[model samples]
Target: MKLLDSGFRRNDNKLFFLTFYDIASPKTGGNMAGKKKGRKISGKKAGLSPGSLVYVGSRTDEPVRISIMDYDADRIDEIPEATLDDIKKCMARDSVTWVNVSGIHDTAIVEAVGRLYHLHPLALEDIVNTRHRAKLDDYENHLFLVLKMVIQEPETIRIVFEHVCLVIGPDYLISFQEREGDVFGPVRERLRKTKGRIRKSGPDYLGYALMDMIVDHYYEVLDQLGEEIEAIQEEALSNPTAKMRRAIHDARRQVVVLRKTIWPLREIVAGLLRGESKLFQDGTMIFLQDVYDHVVQVIDTVETYRDLLTGAMETYMSSVSNKMNETMKVLTIMATLFIPLTFLAGVYGMNFKYMPELEWRYAYPSFWGIVLVVFLAMLLWFKNKNWL
Candidate 1:
């Protein structure tokens, strides 16, 4: 697996490039392999205590890119690859600031941003740990959210599941992502064009916009997965092979992983709908409700894929079984047709003096005639029975 490219950009500008981690391309036509050192498969920090600042993600030389956008109805100021001082200045502003952190491989930068924003230790911990569960934390001052931002692998029917952590504060929206592609590009485009109410709304709406972009993209992924499932189903019914079987299993596994990562997000958004955090303004509740609805749709599509994979697997098994049955039926017919021939041969093969058939003049030809007749009779019977 490898990430060819990913980052936040405006005006067609290249925001950042990931040089260290590239788990975007799956070698085996499925999700990223668990053994890939780039994804920080769990158990790396077994003895480390909670809130440890170690970055439990890919060891990437790609610098942590921070793009800050401070916007209001009056004006908007965008900073590309903002430094610590710039981030400090952004936090001091009264405008709705969106600080997009592209890579979290450097715990130092993440720690600095957390300290500047006064984020909770646990939130900071979750930011660097890619394996953290999808969850939400309301710490009175701000709301921390951990969720998966799914992106599709190009030219392949697979998904790139990247962990995104966010601290939705009253004045700012800070997003932390593993070294992966940009899923929040649309949000930046919206803010840049001032196309929607995002500019007029507060950071709550910005957070909603971010989540909406991610949730809406789920449909695109689902569409691709649906096509893959259909193709697998057709192949399973027609030309089922071991490769097709593995594909169905891989598809099912991807669906299960998707469900596990996305199910908690529904709860997280529902928590916002219930007004669990004060950071979410009343106006934001409707948007959150819409997001919740999209999440439900995504989950439903995932379940449908799961069912399709299950049916395809059964269909493949049934195909193989029918094929085996046909083979065995032919073999059984051949063996049955040869039984009498074998008996006749055995009688003639014996050297007993009382063997009358061996002494007959037409016995050899007669034996062949009987054998041919028995073979044709069995074939005709099998054809009549529709078992041939």
Candidate 2:
């Protein structure tokens, strides 16, 4: 784990978005910082004191990038790596301001952002700890939200997971993402074009837009898993193997993870709707209700996939058991057919000098005839009983 001691440097990739009262905005190119290897998010913060500002994510040499978007209804200005004064100025504006920070690996910059916004220390702690679950917190001045963004990686259908935290203030919005990606393309495009109500709405609407993008991506991720579950189910029906069981387990695990991510978000949204948070307006609540409904739909889909995977696993086990039983039955029938034949051979092999049957000239031939008849009769009986 990298200690928070090397000083903070902004990464190359920074996303800045701002929406003002005038609403017109222009797009600016922002570089995405490359990924780097680091320690596990959960274990990195172990043995540390409470409220420690240690970053608990993979170590990335890429400096934390901060992009600021200052916009109003008339026009929008884009700034990459804006100084502290710029952020404060944007916050003071009556128009909505969105400051997006791409990397949270640097504690100093995160702490600086927190201090500028007067965010609680615990909220900063949660922001640094990537393993934290989806939650919502109200600190009078602003609303803090944590949620998971699950996206499928390209080329391979593997699920890529990241934790995002959003802090919603009176007229400013801040988003912290673990890494750089185009997951927010739709929202960014909306910001650039100013086509929809996102530009016409307040900061709460912008926060909702960001969260909505994250939630919308869940369906795409779930769709991929759904396809996998179908493939595994087909394999289980046709030619089942140990691999199908493993696939079922893996699919179920993914569903479980998605379920965990989506379930909490439902509660968070519902709580916000029910709780008196002045940050959210009546119009925003309507949008939030829609988000909650979407969450329910995603959760339902995940649970359905989970059940299907379980059924596929059960079918595979039953198929293997039936195959084994049929094999044993065939072997048992063969042994039973040999029982009478073995008895006859054993009686004839008894070397008795006074045995009349053994002395008969045609005894060997007659014995063979009897053995043949017995064999045919037993086979006929087996066939009649439908046991063959």
Candidate 3:
């Protein structure tokens, strides 16, 4: 595996390089390439040293890799795998260049890129450690951005999170990704076809395009979530069982998590729009404004889903109450039907010496007739009351 270096002359006439690597090579030594050389410490001594480097991005057994795409309005070049020195030579030219860095787990390669680009240590740290919230940082010479890219796994609704770090300078844009695959295929196609304003624009426009792609994923996710919410609503209305209630609750929690994920994203995009960084040009700001609108739409959709889930919960409760009331009505009707019969049985069961009905043979039949009349009358009364 080779590192790409795009050499650009700084104001001091010093050469700065851009490095690219092909991570699939076994000769690259993978994670062991930059193993720290130091004595192992334990307990208090371990605490004395800086904490162990945490690898928060992609994990791959293959070597690190990089690719460079240098272009302008009339010229374009694609270097599949360029060495660091080769990239440096290209960067010295007047054309706009895009360096794509894939596989950031190797500390040596990451540090080398930082040094070449004169990136701040904290910025390099943020790039190497990927568990960062989405943000935009403006340095004097360039802008650094950290964003999460989400992709839906085929045949499944699950989302995979990938961190993409961007460095936007005057004439170049650097994209750092944890893994190899990306959604920028369309952008590359546009660049190749000279379609739209991409080729005519600068690095800022490129950055906008990439961000727009990322925001589009949010729409896809929101659509799926909306469909799920609708389905849950329908199920709740049709069959209000314990299982349905649990499902509604689970759906509500998922919506809450979705809201949490998307809420801050709006702010991040909004900050980019308002930021004074030269990395975003006037034309690009217009594009970012559109992106901000999309973000707002996403946030609105999430809130709507939350409200629907809440309404479903209420519907479930009402259904349960109605069920309980119906059960009580049936029980009351049964009690009413047995009342007169119970009284008649109690009267006949008594052994009173002066009881006229117990003395004669005809009395037994007549007593049953009287009990039948009482039961019929009570049934009619219940029917009139609409309790049966």
The lDDT of each candidate is 0.76, 0.75, 0.69
For every candidate in turn, the CA RMSD to the true structure comes to 7.1, 9.4, 12.8
Better of 2 and 3 by lDDT: 2
Question: What are the per-model numbers of colliding residue pairs?
Answer: 2, 16, 20
Better of 1 and 3 by TM-score: 1
Candidate 3, lDDT over the whole model: 0.69
Tens digit per residue, CA lDDT, model 1, 278-381: 78889889878989999998999999888888889999999989988988988998888788779978877888888788789999899899878887987798
Best by TM-score: 1
Which candidate has the top score in lDDT?
Answer: 1
Model 3 residue 296 lDDT? 86
lDDT of 2 by residue, 332-372 (tens): 98998889999999998988888899878999999999989
| Candidate 3 RMSD computed on C-alpha atoms after optimal superposition onto the true structure | 12.8
Angstrom error at residue 338, model 1: 1.1
Order by TM-score, highest first: 1, 2, 3
Q: What TM-score, to 2 decimals, does candidate 1 have?
A: 0.86
For residues 1-388, what per-residue lDDT tens digits would candidate 3 score against the true structure?
A: 2221111111232222211121221111121122111121223223433323445543455466788888888888988786677678777989888888877778678777767778777677678665567777787788888887755443333444566889988988888877666667778878888845898789989998898888887787667666666766776676688867766766666666556656667777778788677667787888889988988888888788889989988988888898889899889877877887898889888887787768788987888898788889988988898877
Give the Cα error of residue 296 in candidate 2, in Å.
0.6
